[model samples]
Target chain A: MLAKNKKSLIIFIILSLIGAAIYLFTLSDSFMYQRDIGKITHVSEGSSQRTEDEFKNVDHQHEQKITMIMLNGKQKGKKIHTHNSWSNSGAFDQKFHSGQQVFVDLQKQNGRTTAEISDYKRDTYLLMLGWVVISLLILTMEFKGLKTLFSVVLNFVVFLLFIELDVKLNLTNFFWLFVLSAFIFTALSLLIVIGWNKQCAVTFASIVIGTTGALMIGVLVLNYTGNDLHYEALDFATQSPKQLFLSATVIGLLGAVMDAATDIVSTVFEIKRSHPQIDQKQLFGSGIEVGRAILGPLINVLLLIFFAETFAMGVLFFRTGNSIGYTFEWTMSLGIVQSLISGIGITLVIPAASAFAAWAFRKEGQVENN
Target chain B: MKTISILTVILAFLMVLVGGKQGFSAFFSVLINFLLLFLNIMLISSGFPPLWTSLFSGICILAITIYMGNSDEKSSNVAFLATLAVMVVMLLLIVPLDHLVQVKGFANEQSEEIEAFNLLVGVDFEKIAISTTILSTLGAIAEAAIAIASGLNEVIEQDPQITPLKLRKSGQNIGSQIMGMTFNTLFFGMFGGDLALFILLNKLHNSFGYYLNSKIFVSECMLVLYSAIAVILVIIVTTWLMSRKVRPQRSA
Candidate 1:
């Protein structure tokens, strides 16, 4: 145990050092628009508070003198001075600390370039956080942890590739693309985790059927209620709003459905292993009972996630003195609707997975009987 | 809004049709749990402190879900205590992490929306961020804790003479199976929730690096990590609680 601890410590140190090196030195290439990398050198306070009558009691505002040194692009190694205002309320007003890296977007006029801080260089921090999570996972579960991490990376890679394909193809019918991608994702993810087995097959079938059933239910509810699927809360959409909503619904339900199915099937498999003489009818009944126990909490998980994402917007609306009715209608209504739809999917998966597991396990029983 | 009501009615009807009375009770519990969440948010908006509001609602949701989902008092008690314990620990971690990450408030792109409203309502966006993270993670953590606790209890009940070590092993096995599914649920849920934003990023021709640095993306990622951490911690806590509880009974 001591040696194992020492080995994990060494691995953690090495990973951390590597992460720090990458964060400090790695330079990102500019995208379609040119951008210069800069580090904050100095900050001086200007305005200290908001004087507006309504804001006097409620706002924390600070104007600051900011100095930065350009690290890349044509303005490499040049010093620039800029003004920044920090507001507690505004969306973009940020309080920048010294030594933080920022992306400087420059404009050229009258033979001189003026730069403004567009956004902070935040990827390094994200990488650092990723390292922490990965290291902890590795330390705890070891080999299985490593495999889980691999599948996670693979899931992301697959998702990115699907997004890239969707962009290139410019598909008008996003429903098919999303459905196909969901299928591929479900197959690969289950295969990677559980491998090619009867359990995996059962889970895959249940997930597909469950998510599809939920998607159909979502569509029916949307159509029957005559609810406009226009998601104005989301910024600029290039595709049809309805299509976007549908695609989001499908993607969201996929994980929960798969999770519910996997949970029920795995439990049933365990039961089968322990009670080898149990008949198919009894096994199926047990699976359904397990699903029932899990469905409530699982649905709550999805609902909380969906609502939590929109919580801030809802609060902001209410903070502005909007009525509860208006705030609920405008800010959280869509999220609530989405959660309910996903809940339907999660709920349906319970029986779907049970039936699939029952069928698969029954087949094995028949084989043994012969 | 109308759609939510309609969906709720439909879900309640279906739950009854499928699981009979217990299903209806579960559906009602979930419905009430959602209302509690809605009311909590309303309370926060009505000037209640975000922290207390979250704590209150978290407990209420945990109790309602566990009690309604599991018929046995012993199982519900174990689940509730284990879940609450884990939630407290997760919330403690969230405070410091929220400060370190500093991805609070709306993204710059959301300025237009904020501009349309009064920005001086004096609400601390930092607290809002922490509260939102806690609220979002509460459900996943509670669900995982309940699942593991009740699962271990079921194993123990079947073989009451099972040793503590064996119970712990089974608990670990159960946890391992559930962890992957729980993590994926969170990942896909976030992915699906933010699909439109991703498409926007794609359409705007933002580079991969830009997508990573984007505020919304970063916050969403942070939310995923927070919940993941909560799930991990809950598994450990539930296992430990189950093992400790089973030992005395086994010896007796």
Candidate 2:
């Protein structure tokens, strides 16, 4: 058994390295479409830096003569040339170098084929990184990892379907649209991952109550406050940011909340299973203890992810001499709101789960007596 | 603003009402984490390099999450060490990958909003992106570390005679259980963060292929995958360290 474990570990390591190399370098060869893929062969030197008026900062803009060989399109295998310019900011533009695979629009002008860089061909890199992650998950957890991968993919599909249905059907009342989406996502993910069992049932119920309650309370507070929630921060959102933010809160909070519930419920149920005669009070107490233990780490998880996404923007705001309060209002407010709502959901789910476990076990105890 | 104030009040009230002393501590820790995040942003905006700021705050946040979450000295110490190791590994990986991927700076999606702002604040957006990725993985790492360390310690106390190898096995069991939920949390967090954007993307009728190649989608997926990998790293580190801890005790 020890030898087998060591052997599998070796195999996993070897496969990971080889897979990384193959996926990183050779993925371009596997695509079927012949439209707009090119491999950069040479890049000419860029010009020197120049200062900018805005922000009184140094900005550099230079155009490099990039030469590439087209891997697809009518000009397949033909050499092409284009000028790629970039700057210190590189916000909307980027510098390209040799060995980069980019999608290009082919132009035939004056008996010469010049290509316009459209976007980077990034699917290969994603595939490589994704391969590493999926392999690690499977290596660590085996069958369960496969199940997890399946559940996640299914959830992604459902999410895509939700997007399609909402847009195609032109569904309004985003409150209900997202509320219903939250429910469907929760039920489907839990069912596929954990299956329909007694423990799952308890987790499902607690999550439902916790999510809906959080949603309603958030909406209630918004209504009472006349709905001022820094919606302008969610720029480019076509829908109501209020509904978007609230929906994002529930769905965002659901996973961590579900995790907390499962941990507590499973602990309480474990106690009850081991000691069938244990009273509801003792079991309920255990659940709360478990819940409390999970709170800090779980809350941090939500806080850090949400905060990181906005940190750069907030910093930009601060650098521009925006007041802290003003910066917070514009850059960090929506994320903070999301985190606050999710934090509330996570905290509330615990006691609700603990109480449910105590009740479920007591009911089972009575059923056994009957 | 009113919405946030009300939500903050509601959150404070619910937290205090839930776990009582522990709930208050959890709430306090969250506040500290946020304050640190703000300080981190301020320091970077003032020309403190983002990479160093992130490393400093990352360790501080990891310590807060583990020590405050578990509250048991020995187990949390082990957790902190394990989380630190995983974080260092993640940092090394992220630096190179961030350069290779080039998903830094404001994405095209944010172009309209950022048109008026000056990006030449003398800060490298590439380094800032790395910092953000580093910060994003802390919670997951710290959470994974604490979960495994505490669970393994519990097993050791329960079975004082358990061998190091056996303890390692037990750690794997516990880590796998925690991982199921951790992966879900990370994945759904990604989905939830963009559910609205997804609706808009669909409305624009962008193809799946387009979404796949888009910088925003790739970076978002990369974040989720990186977090997952960090969790896996923490599990291994915590388990190995914990097994050694058990080994010393078993001989004595």
Candidate 3:
């Protein structure tokens, strides 16, 4: 077993290195086409003379001066200077740093070379790091870790596949896609990690009941709330907007909430296994206690994970003196509502997951008695 | 039935009354934390770099974690200290990655949304986009911190004799239990909102390789990693913190 395991480890590392190489190669090529190398000669804070009405309501607008290093060819080694507007936007923030190397878009007008800071190559490299870490984790964990890591890789692939299908095929039926992704991701995640077994089956069943049932509740609540509370402040896509936002909310909550539900259910079942004499009421109470313990932290989990990504926007609002209500309405409100719904889903799943586990194992016990 | 219902109501009322105060404080922590994110974005919009924005965000997360941790004063202070230490460690790990990754803008998909809203309301779309991404992960970071701190506190309480090594092992064991589900939570939580995007991206025959490489996809995935790493860091640090405090207290 040890020898076989070692062999598998070698295989995993080889495969990971290949993936890393491919990822790195693609990254180098993508950014090489549009390079904007520059250095920040001066950094200063400047306010927009333009009202909110000016500049197309960009998420963040920053005035920064950049001394261009080299754009494309001949004078590439030479440092040409220019001033450019940088935003809190992800790409520009990377390019327009002080006294740092940058690659910007160069425009030639009347023999003077000018560069506008564009895409940041750093993002590609950061992503490479994320993948590399994941690969290393899989290689290290060997079996269980590899399984979990594979589940992550699998979900990413499924998500990519699903995204392309929706965009290219232009599937108007958004609801089905939501359901299918939820089912497939949840099942695959559980199957790949936990494997096929009665316990795994129970966990799977609980996840379905817990996640789906909670989702139904969430959908009902959203409908009841009239969707007015849904933060339209988020720059949701307009062309196929409503459907897209709905899908995003559903998919975001599905994994975390479902995972929480399964964990709680299986945990209670494990407790029962060790203490078989523990009765149904005791089992039920244990489930509730577990749920209670996790409830606050779990909500925080979703709230922080979902909202952290958007912190840049929230900070912009407060700094710009946008009213708290105004900021909430557009920026943080939708996330709040989403987190709340997931919270409710998670809270309800406690009972649902536990109840299903209780029923399954009890039935199994009866069969054993017979 | 009436008795059970009444008892249930009373229990909830107490839980809220007890947990409610914590809840309110948590709410404020969240609110202040949100404000900090908005501030970072505005600062970034006004020409401060994302590195600064991320630093400010880190301080705010630390403050909020401390505030939320200190709510109970007596008991929770320990949790708070542990949580704060964990958060600091996480910040050390996560802040560098933000720099290294240099994720600079929102996906093009979001640009249209920003532009449309920009036309209507006159808000700077770029600032809005940056703030949104940063804000999205803050809640998760705080939650993970609390989990690691609180979980470590519980472990130490159960086994006061837990040596430093044992405590670290215990924390990791418990964290493994928590992470078994928590990692999944981070994973699905990320793509959860954009289900349609997944369908669209897939239908277009966007390969796994391509999506893995896409800016937006990578950003979301990294955030998940950041959250997971933050959670792990919290576990390690809190274990250390708890051992320091617990060891002294026991000796005293």
Candidate 4:
């Protein structure tokens, strides 16, 4: 058994290294860069000139070049320079100095790549920082922590896989798929962590009940409120507006709902395990208590993280002299709607998860006692 | 305040204060992460080698993690092993999924607006959009990896002689608790930003089915799913890898 464990460890390590290598290689230059020869064709200030009102007559024509150096690659060795152009919309706003080299993507002109002049001094430092941080995180965590990290990676792959499959198949009936995926995802994840056991089963059931209940409640509330659902803050969405909005609503609530469920079910289960004599009502009460304690703060964290992201847009809109109404209508207001939807989902999940957990534990208690 | 209560409050506050200070490094790490996104966009626009551009971003993030985390050698070594493990899993999952999902392009109003911006700026809006999706997931995945890794290490600190089964069990327990909250973190993290739009859409009196059909709504849904799946897999992979390192316990 010991030898088997060692062999598995060795295999895991070898596979991990290989996977890392592939990830690094593929991600090495997946970004599309634009090169500039230090020239500006157009500039818009205040509200971007490309307003919804003005979009009809928005002149779509421009030409310019900005010179910049490549901050990375074999091209780093060459004194490589290129000319880039801009169109009528106010996409590229900042100007570059002659000596200040910037990072960007190359545009193909007659099979030759040309620079599109994006920005000076790309924040490669930050990317490095992220990796380093991740590295440091794993090191501190040791082996088990390492495994947890691997699970996260695998989960992401699953997400990407499902997304691609849906897109390729063009499956319109995504809601069912989502529900099914949520279950599979939640179950497999918990199973791996908790292993094959009644405890995991209970937790899995709890997560489902919590997430589904919260989602349903959110759906009902949205219906009752009528259709003023706003998601205008999402930048560059340019997709089916209404569909995107609805999907975001469902997806948005899922996390909080799941979280609440996990928290309630696990905490209750722990309580039951530690105190076998604890009755249903007491166990239920403790679940509720834990849920209540965590809910408010969790909501707040979401709010802060979400709101702060829109700060730039808000400032940009306000700076443009747009009325508060216009800015809110087109900018961060959608974020508010998204937030409330999630908040409501979170609120519902707490009670529902706890309730389900209480009932499940009580049933289990009976089975064990019998 | 009563003396004991006061002392308790002081201690609690001190923990927050200390944690806050510690979190600053994490926060900086996050800030640098965002900067990398912006810079990646900028680099793509500037015509650098795409590989080098991404590499630069990755390197930058890596540096910030090292500098700001101020983690000691022992912790760094652990973090490396853990992150490597997770990254490997992330790659295994992400590569295949990318083949499956392809991250559909802007099919809504925002895409047009972005296109207008691109037309004006000569930027490849599609490229930007794809980059954004990838970058967005990166942060969430990285955060989960860090949190799980850190939590596991703390468990080890408490009992070095923890058996493989015991450690695995504990990791799962920890993962379970985290699973509950992390979704909230990811869900609210994604949804909170788009709240007003939902409320407004709700006011429009659209049917539930209709509301779900919006392009932006679908895209966001896609993102949420992506994040959730990522969170779930991370836990599994983490547990699997960690189990290998622990020494097997004898029958008691």
Candidate of highest lDDT: 2
What is the CA-based DockQ of model 1?
0.56
Query: Tens digits of per-residue lDDT for model 3 on B114-200?
Result: 443332223333434434444454455445445545555544544566677666655544454455556677777876665544444
- Number of clashes in every candidate structure? 0, 0, 94, 161
Residue-wise lDDT of candidate 3 within A237-355, one digit each (tens)?
43355556656767777766666565556555555543576677666665554454455556656766666656545554555456766766677666666665565556556667667
Model 2 global lDDT (CA atoms, 0 to 1): 0.78
How many collisions between residues are there in candidate 3? 94
Model 4: per-residue Cα lDDT over B160-196, one tens digit each: 6667777677666667557545754565466533543
List TM-score (chain A only) for every prediction.
Answer: 0.87, 0.89, 0.72, 0.67
Native-referenced Cα lDDT, model 1: 0.76
Q: What's the C-alpha lDDT at position A278 in model 1?
A: 66
- TM-score against truth, every candidate: 0.91, 0.92, 0.69, 0.51
Model 2, A195: alpha-carbon shift in Å? 3.1
> If you superpose only chain B onto the true chain B, what TM-score does each candidate give?
0.92, 0.92, 0.69, 0.71
Off by over 4 Å in 4: A1-78, A82-115, A118-130, A171-173, A224-226, A230-239, A363-370, B1-176, B179-184, B191-252
Which is better, 3 or 4, measured by DockQ? 3
What is the C-alpha local distance difference test score of each model?
Answer: 0.76, 0.78, 0.56, 0.48
Candidate 4 lDDT, tens digit per residue, A1-370? 9996797677667656755664454333313322222222233322223322332323344333443445455455334455534333223333233444344555668966666543333222222323433443344344544554555456545654555454555455655554555566666556554556665666666566546654565455556555554544355443445455555555555555555566556656655654576678877776665554444333433433444344334433433345656655665455555545555555556556667667875554642320
Candidate 2 residue-wise lDDT, A1-370, digit = tens: 9997998889798877878686856556525544488899999986756756555555676679999988876777888888887777565667888999888988778987667998887777677778888888778777777777787788788778877776777656765776677777778767765667776788889988777677678778878888466775785577777667766777788888877777676656555643577788877887787777778888899889888988768867876778989998888888888888888888889889999989897655632210
